[model samples]
Target: MKLWIKLAAALLSGACTVASAQNFPNRPVRIILAITPGSVADAIARFMSQDLTARLGQPVVVENRAGGGGAVAAEACKQAPADGHTLCMLHVSTFSLNPFTMQRLSYDPFKDFKPVTRMFFINEALVVSPAVAARSVEELRKLLVANSGKFSYATLQLPGADYFQAGLSEQWGAQVIAIPFKGGGEVVTALLSDQVNIGYAGAGNFAEHVKAGKIRMLAVNAGSRLKEFPNVPTFGEAGIKPFKIKAWWGMFAPAGTPEEIVNRVNTELSRSLADAKVRQYVEERFMESAVTANPAEFASFVRQDYERGGALVEEIKRAAGNK
Candidate 1:
């Protein structure tokens, strides 16, 4: 009699779990953005919303909460119910850089959230203004060494720019300045007006400008040469140490979300990217498609990136101190 009762209880538990997955996201779903509108991540989030709503049988909304280098959006995501209704868009900065760079971080990335799937990976380009005479990384280094304290670079909200600036300064024995901007558009403007000598950002930000011959891409932090810019060499080919961490965007839900719900969302998002139009949009934006086999794979990637960020922070500290 005791064995029969136990088996009945187990069957009931399994039934309830299946039911929960079927009824998930009954209301409108929200995707919190870590950056403001007009950014690459923001555009992708908004693009995915329509397809996700159809696939999930509910409305999907995107909300921008950009500030604190992704802390504001991250906090909002952490506070949301772990019911898979509220998702957040996080990049390398959120999982990798923020913990080390930002003080008094309100939420722990691994503890506070669950990885869904990586949306895309952006290859960061190190570009120089047309006004600058440098044509390659080697030339740029020579220019920096020759003109210390006279060159500056504009960066987005992430502190990785500071690391790049410091690394270059220490390596070349120059005073390279890093100016922070709120968005990529601002960074582009700074470079276009020759306000800054160089700019480090996603290749998409300067795609049109580069084609127009307004800015010159010295090097890209990609594993191989980009097809769009086959002539441009990678950092390794340019004789510079490639950045250890990659800049990628992924989806996340508040921790404690049911595994079934998380998997369901991941499946839908993957299907959405499979659409030809979506794939084209991503490519035109200069983003590499970075879909993972499963959420566990993404989680593993994040853990590795987190360790790399720690190493980078130490390197930045040493470089800054030496300078």
Candidate 2:
């Protein structure tokens, strides 16, 4: 009788666990953001949260941890329970650049996290102050080469040792100085104040300034023209086809999360992306919608990006050494 009772208890416990996993997200879900409130990442998080809440019938709360260039929130997500209720909305830097730039990271981006789905890809643009004599990308390249060390370009950080700016300098053979700032807003301030002659950041950061004619956009780092800046040519269009980079954003769950729960979250995220309102919001925000990919496909994409970014970082380090 004792043996039978113990067996029954074990079976009941296992059944309860299975039931709970099947239902999934029985409580409010937390979406962690690694950047400050009112940032582009935050805005994108909020947009997804609203659509997700409506579709899932549970509130999706966005919590901002904001420090260490997204490592704070990323580590927090890493420590959270792998129950699918806790997830993160991470930018390109979180997975690609941070791993290469930081000497020590608390979590392995690929090992500690599971890819859910990509949200959007934001194309970066190269902008110069009106005072700079560069109307096009070709002209900008000539100016940068001619001026060389005389001019400085401001960016969010020290080109991350593997970031787009560092790679760009190597490709162009220009010795333009790099000025590191705290955030995108500061990059703009440095440019406006004449502290920096040129800047490279998200197109969203310069959208308003470009519209105001305070700064001139030489070229975008996209394969084609951006909808928001139809007049601004792509690097290819401007005859500098080698310089192209797009920063992407995606959702990730902690590693060891149940496959069923991962699928559920991916399903809801796909639904959200397909919604007309969500599409419009992303388009207006200067984000290109991610091509629909299932969990396995998304994971493969992440791995490819990781390897590509690693190679890019190596090239950057080599260039930095030569300089």
Task: Find the candidate with the highest lDDT and give its number.
Answer: 1
Q: Once superposed on the true structure, which residue ranges of model 2 sit more than 4 Å away at CA? A: 1-16, 180-183, 243-245
lDDT of 1 by residue, 250-296 (tens): 89999988899999999988888888888888877888888654899
Model 2 deviation from native, Cα RMSD in Å: 3.1
lDDT of 2 by residue, 197-252 (tens): 88887677778889999989988877688877889998777765452235788888
**TM-score on alpha carbons, each prediction:** 0.88, 0.87
For each candidate, how many residue pairs have backbone atoms clashing (under 3 Å)? Answer: 0, 0
**Would you list the C-alpha lDDT of every candidate in the order shown?**
0.84, 0.78
Off by over 4 Å in 1: 1-20, 157-161
Candidate no. 1 TM-score: 0.88
RMSD (Å) of each candidate, 1 decimal: 3.6, 3.1
Q: After superposition, how far is residue 94 of candidate 1 from its true place, in Å?
A: 1.0
How far residue 81's Cα lies from its native spot in candidate 1, in Å, is 2.4
